[model samples]
Target: MGQFKVIVVGAGPVGLVLAIALQKSGIDFVVVEQRKQVPPPTAFGIFLWPHILRIFHQLGLYEDMQSIGQVMTKLENRSSTGEHLEISNSFELLEFAHGYPTMLFDRRTFAEVLMKNLKRSDQLVKTNKKVTNITTRKDGVTVDFADGTSERGSIVVGADGVWSTVRDFMRERAPPGLFSEGPNPFIAPYQGLFFRVPRPESLKPGQTVYVHQPNKQLMALVTATEAHMTTYERVPDVSERTYFSPNKVTDEDVKYWFDVPVNEQITFKDLWDDKVMGGKVNHDEGVIPWWHWDRLVLVGDSVHKVECSMSPFRGAGARCGIEGVISLVNKLNRTLNSNPDPSRQDLSRAFTAYQVEREPAARLWVHVSRLDIDLYTSKAGPASKAATFADGRTIPIVANSPVLDILPFPDEKEGVVPWRRHPKADGQSKDVKARL
Candidate 1:
């Protein structure tokens, strides 16, 4: 019953950030979320990279996030026996290299900040309105919700996450050979269990630590209120079976993975039993083949999902989603401006442009993330021994080198995305806006 230029189909970090960006660009948009209410607290924390930090700064969220999020100043990797494999003064290098220290913030706090910033005169986010279908017409697109309500918009952005409904719609309408020809490209082979608990005394607040094993890994990070942990063990039978669907995983099912040494004094099970806050849940990983089709496009986990580091943020879900929208918004600014009465073909071209810009970076990250996982879980091998070197000295300098610049080659700016041209490119330059 309402008209808008852009309809964002998710209220996660990416969708909310897109709404904020569109509003700042003076574009009319609305966000739809399936959840009826705010979800329960998660044992998830984010370790934002430099380019991620720079975008936060662009959006005027840097300082506010700094206040709520802790500045992560060091990087240390250790063995299950508490032996340091590689340790470095990461804060100085991060700050000197990117002008921003890596940040550690609980997912709840980060999401709250984004939600608060989007609060305005108009209700931009409509919850419990699960999008069931998206139909494209000559005029634009129509999105129908499960509740029997509908809205019309010039475009629909499927920020609905890794298992995206909009993505399904796009695939159904995809031209021959448009995407890959195979099993779910978006869901990776690895599955993980995670939860948050009261911060343990052994782990310093704001610090992230990973204890490695060749077959499995135990990862932890501490925030002001809670500590988060996760495990990524190899599953040999994954190729034949589908572990992509939601599993009502119990602690006992994953007890073997977390029953390891955190230090000399405490065991992971002790923490799990004493103070765990959320149920242990399993999520899939992998980069998808396609991002957009005609009036519909995907962002965040919907397009690409990877295990970048041992932790949740390691998947880099937050940053990927935010960057995806910024790219889309930028392309839209040009396409919509040039053709006020844009055709379906015109919108398709615009969608293709967005995918072209974001796909390379996202694909590269997932590829390298496969390597990151190999290193973190290596018990013994050339790659494992090399990555396990002290300060990574014995290994090829590449191990210690800047990843954003090197491994994910062809990055616009090495190590950091120092500046974002979208908000300004969209002609909303009073203050260039973007976000997480």
Candidate 2:
């Protein structure tokens, strides 16, 4: 490639964060989104776990987030009929494990903040640009939009997401037995409707409540003025797990699981009735072996789909994508420092490093999330109840442990940790310091 420019397809949270980071570095990059404009973000709340918060701190937005986001201190549990189960100091546990509280912010607020502070001009974030084709040549990659327009860059990133067209660009280059989509290692053992509704007067602010039945569940996050809720039920796995499009789901389709009891005051139907925003999406999970082939690299839901969770942080989608972006970019920076621009081999090394460092952590999150789904949907027999209680007691202990201890990264350099729930104070924020 003659010039070092990055063409990023999709302007999701992860993509925007990458764009912002690139803009701050004065790198040449363009972001494309399929939507025509920034819409009011969906009602889901994005919970930034401690690990991701440190990433934001490096991005220079942590303090700003702390000021605007709601801080969660506890997660209360109950039976489907509103019988109280137990309350755990979830936020406190995270704080004890890391040095920061888990914060809850509307997805829309986060998007706006990223867009506002991005050093690039608004036009740099293109909209209504659905990528139709990706053509990689000896020199560079060309991205064709639905509007008969195209852009070329040194490399095209498939940040476009799960149904990513950029992923198709690598089909010819993909190594044997390394197709990005294949026998899905991850499966959906549950499905549900997620909703956003007004916060109830009776619910405590900044507190999360989870109501569960053997085959049904309800989770709500109460803010100062609104609530975001989701209800999941034990559903047999579909042959095709991921919901490829919004059109795949509809209001009529969501009614099948509508009668499950959520609380004394509300059932699934009642929750749906009061919902201001809602949608049905399957919680599919998987990890891809071929994250990159030749010039194409994936970010976000394209290559790795984490288990769905009522707690936003647990899904680990956005945070993982951000990690991918940082890892890829840092590797590229090292390569570029040695050469004006990297060759194909250099790009391959970077992509490999990105996947190697991230794969184990992604697997760990999905494994734990699967356990969560199993525990919630399993027959609530006395033994199961005891296990749930045991888990509640162990969550903090697990959180307090060093993250790298469990999910080891391939290349752990001095002064930088891959990710830690609790890090040695001396090495804390080492990555942030180096990047900033």
What is the C-alpha lDDT profile of model 2 across 91-159, one tens digit per residue?
776666555567778888888888877765487888888887877777778888899898888788888
Off by over 4 Å in 1: 1-4, 119-122, 175-183, 237-251, 257-259, 279-283, 308-315, 381-436
Residue 58 in model 1: shift from native, Å? 1.7
Candidate 1 versus truth, CA RMSD in Å, comes to 6.0
Clashes of each: 4, 0
lDDT for each residue of candidate 1 in 134-170, tens digit (9 for 90 to 100): 8987778989999999978988998877667788787
Off by over 4 Å in 2: 39-41, 172-176, 180-186, 241-269, 381-436
The CA lDDT at 193 in model 2 is 64
Span of 10 residues, lowest total lDDT, candidate 2: 400-409
RMSD from true fold, candidate 2: 5.7
Candidate 1, position 302, lDDT:
77
Superposition TM-score, candidate 1 onto the true structure? 0.83
